[model samples]
Target: MGIKAFLSEPLARYIVAQQHEWIAASREVQEKWRTGLVQKAMNTQFGKDHFFKDIHSYVDFKSAVPVSDYEDLKGYISKIKEGEENILWPGKPLYFAKTSGTTSGTKYIPISKDSISNHINSARNAILTYIAETGKAQFLDNKLIFLSGSPVLTETGGVLTGRLSGISNHHVPAYLRANQLPSYETNCIEDWETKLDKIIDETIDQPMSLISGIPPWVQMYFDRIIARTGKKIKDVFPEFSLFIYGGVNFEPYRAKLFESIGKPIDSIELYPASEGFFAYQDSQDEEGLLLLLDTGIFYEFIPTENFFDENPKRLSIGEVEIGKNYAMIINNNAGLWGYSLGDTIRFVSTNPYRVLVTGRIKHFISAFGEHVIGEEIEKALRYGMERHPEVEVVEFTVAPMVAPEQGGLPYHEWLVEFATLPNNMEQFVQDVDRRLTELNVYYDDLIKGSILRQLVLKPLRKNSFIDYMRASGKLGGQNKVPRLSNDRKIADELTKINQ
Candidate 1:
């Protein structure tokens, strides 16, 4: 084995051993974090206002702090922006993770010195966990490419501000930094296409062992690799053994991505955000990402059905059950109190507390009383594609078609971009609809009641979604096309772009 691989093995084993301890004591670890975080923030303005000192139990914590979105914390965030100290956490945040908001315009999420470790170390531990479990650490010996936003950052309210990926770039350990590609100069380019081109130029001839990015963007990279060299990625990077991805479901992009690579590679999925690094795939044998209980964050779950209710029941780690969808809430060391993450997840295993990201709370199609979620649609499409091995999906989005221009019944419109169109389009549609019906009984009821027609599949022109994203100036960097929408805003734009 090479020097890098030889050294990483022992460290990997130690990390996994430590992780197992926390995983085994999941509930206790969470309780500890909850109590500790509350104590740490007790002197802060938000803590005083929320009566943090009186939070002796989970019930008290819930009563003291209401579940909050970004808007709810904007006041404190605004103060922090203007150089306020000890407003939320113990003191001023190390940085602000700037993200484009839907209703709030631009949001600045604070990253405390204590909390940044979770973001950086959780990622490291994930790799270590993989190395420990699979006994495959040789990837450390070669080049590793992380397709990410520019590391260039600007200041906001005296704090450095940038996308989470860009902020993460600054924290990458010197050891990995030595093997990381494309060069720092290439990573600083603003335009995604130009940066991607530069990345290709820098790494096309290198000994790449791992590629990490959001799936769609990585797919773009693989496509570019193929186009430039007229060879599959595996041919170009024979040692490439791992693909680490997050931000979107991989199933939809899996087939096309593997086709581009000409072979399959092990992959790790991460549940990370501007708020915190939540979970990471810990084992190759496991079906779900292992939820991080000791990560300076306390987690809560509200049944997805009760998410919009006036007083939804919030359950702690010990109270949650497997297989039920819940909207995730977090109270973290970063000073976010009862923060609603806007994402929904289902626990797949309770023994060690592993979860599958089900969908987003707002990214669902509940039009016509048929609540269809991202997971269902992605699963249904995958089910159909499994039957028709010829079909290769590039990208897809579903939106409610409340009214059809041709005067037919309103239906769910699926705008799909196919890399290779199915020979039997009609059969493929029927299979997808069938799977969706089986997965969502409400949708099946709508179809049976004639309240909605069977979903209409609209084939999109090449790079239709890419064009739409580029037009909106959201071509890359953690931006994801919503899988399901209740309205026609994205649908209409996609149609126009396809035209």
Candidate 2:
């Protein structure tokens, strides 16, 4: 066998073997995992305060370590930022991943050597798992293009801060360089539009097999590629068969992205955040990502319905039930302890532990007691798509049209940018409204009682979201518009931009 082929087989075998172990692991086996990770960090300052040294079981771990947010850990992280060693983890962090400052300003998350390895291995395992499942080993033959963040990193208080993609780009195996596109030098360019132009010029004629990024930015790249070459994306990269995406739900952007492709191609949704590689799309037949149970990260779940209680109960992986919204708490080798990543998820399957990312904890819309999240918006849109196959909705965001001082009930304002609007736009809105009511009982009650006005649909010019993001200085690389917001803040901003 050739060298690449030889390398691929063993990795695929290893991942498949691990998958079997994960699926068969008993509740006791998984709980022991939580204990083991806690024990490893027991020597750190965080561990000492939380009495990790005295912990013996999952019950002790949860009761001792309080669920924390970024602010709660900021003091300890500040010490690490000032060159403190062994505060959160042993020795100093090699790098700090700067998060997109959507809710909590830009956060500098420490990335230890162990955490870096976890990210890389998890990514490889994902690909190998795909190979084991689909037998598509041909994917390794062509270039893989990642439309990533600017690699030009900056130092802050002895820590390097940059986008997660830029921060992790250098750690990838050098052997894979031959098949990776957009030279390192080009990836460092600050201006996204300029960088995209350079990337299109460099990759439009290459033997590309994969394109991976957040969907909106990927759509922008696809749009440019089509415009530049005057041919379909499939024609430009015939080997381009798989799209790996994360940092946002793929459902809303899927139809818009497919409009750029000449033929059908498979896609995978990843659940990776700046903290670590959490989960990934393991099976094409499945709707949710298989939670990474064995990685350096340990997980706890706090049901969203009871999140604000004086003391919310935290459940371990083995105890979590399917169909409940839980805010995630992660403890990782990256020195994060009980850190509330602000993301929410629901267990779609419990036997093997698969989860669907529901949305961000701070990103839901509950303005009128109708709690609508990112997942609901996506599901509602998909339902609308099922009813109208011809309509190609490109991008959208929703905000509440709160009751004006003049009077009348409040309703939802949907700003949609479509590649082609449905022939019956009014029916399209009705379909969305009907689906949303079906998904949210509170919403159904409101509409039935006439307590809220019917939903309003506003068709935006194509690339309106793109234009808004670019104007806000967050046009690319894991940056996404919040799909649902409680207030009119973002909606008013976008409305003004088009004017």
lDDT, candidate 2, residue 363?
A: 81
TM-score of each: 0.99, 0.96
Put down candidate 2 lDDT per residue, 1-499, tens digits, no spaces: 3366557877798878978786788465557667776777888888888888888877787778788888888898889988887888887887888885655687888988778877878887888888777877676777888889987788866777787888768766777778888999889888889999999988988989888888888888999988888888988899899999898877777776887887888878888888888888889898799888777778889999878788998888877998999999988887788788889999999877899998988787788899888888889888888788887877888898887556788888889888888888889889999999999999989889988877888889867887888888888777888888888888998898778
Best candidate (score: lDDT) = 1
Which tens-of-lDDT digit does each residue in 1-499 have in candidate 1? 8898899999998998888798788888999999999999999999999999898998899899999999999999999999889999998999899888777899899999999999999999999989999999999989998988888989887889999999999999998899999898988988989989989999999999999999999999999889889999999999999999999999988989999988888999999999999999998888999999998999999999999999999999999999999999999888898999999999999988999998999889987888899899999999989999989998999999987989978899999999999899999999999999999999999899888898899999999989999998999888888888889898899988877
Q: What TM-score does structure 2 among the candidates reach?
A: 0.96
Off by over 4 Å in 1: none
Cand. 2 Cα-lDDT: 0.83
lDDT of 1: 0.92
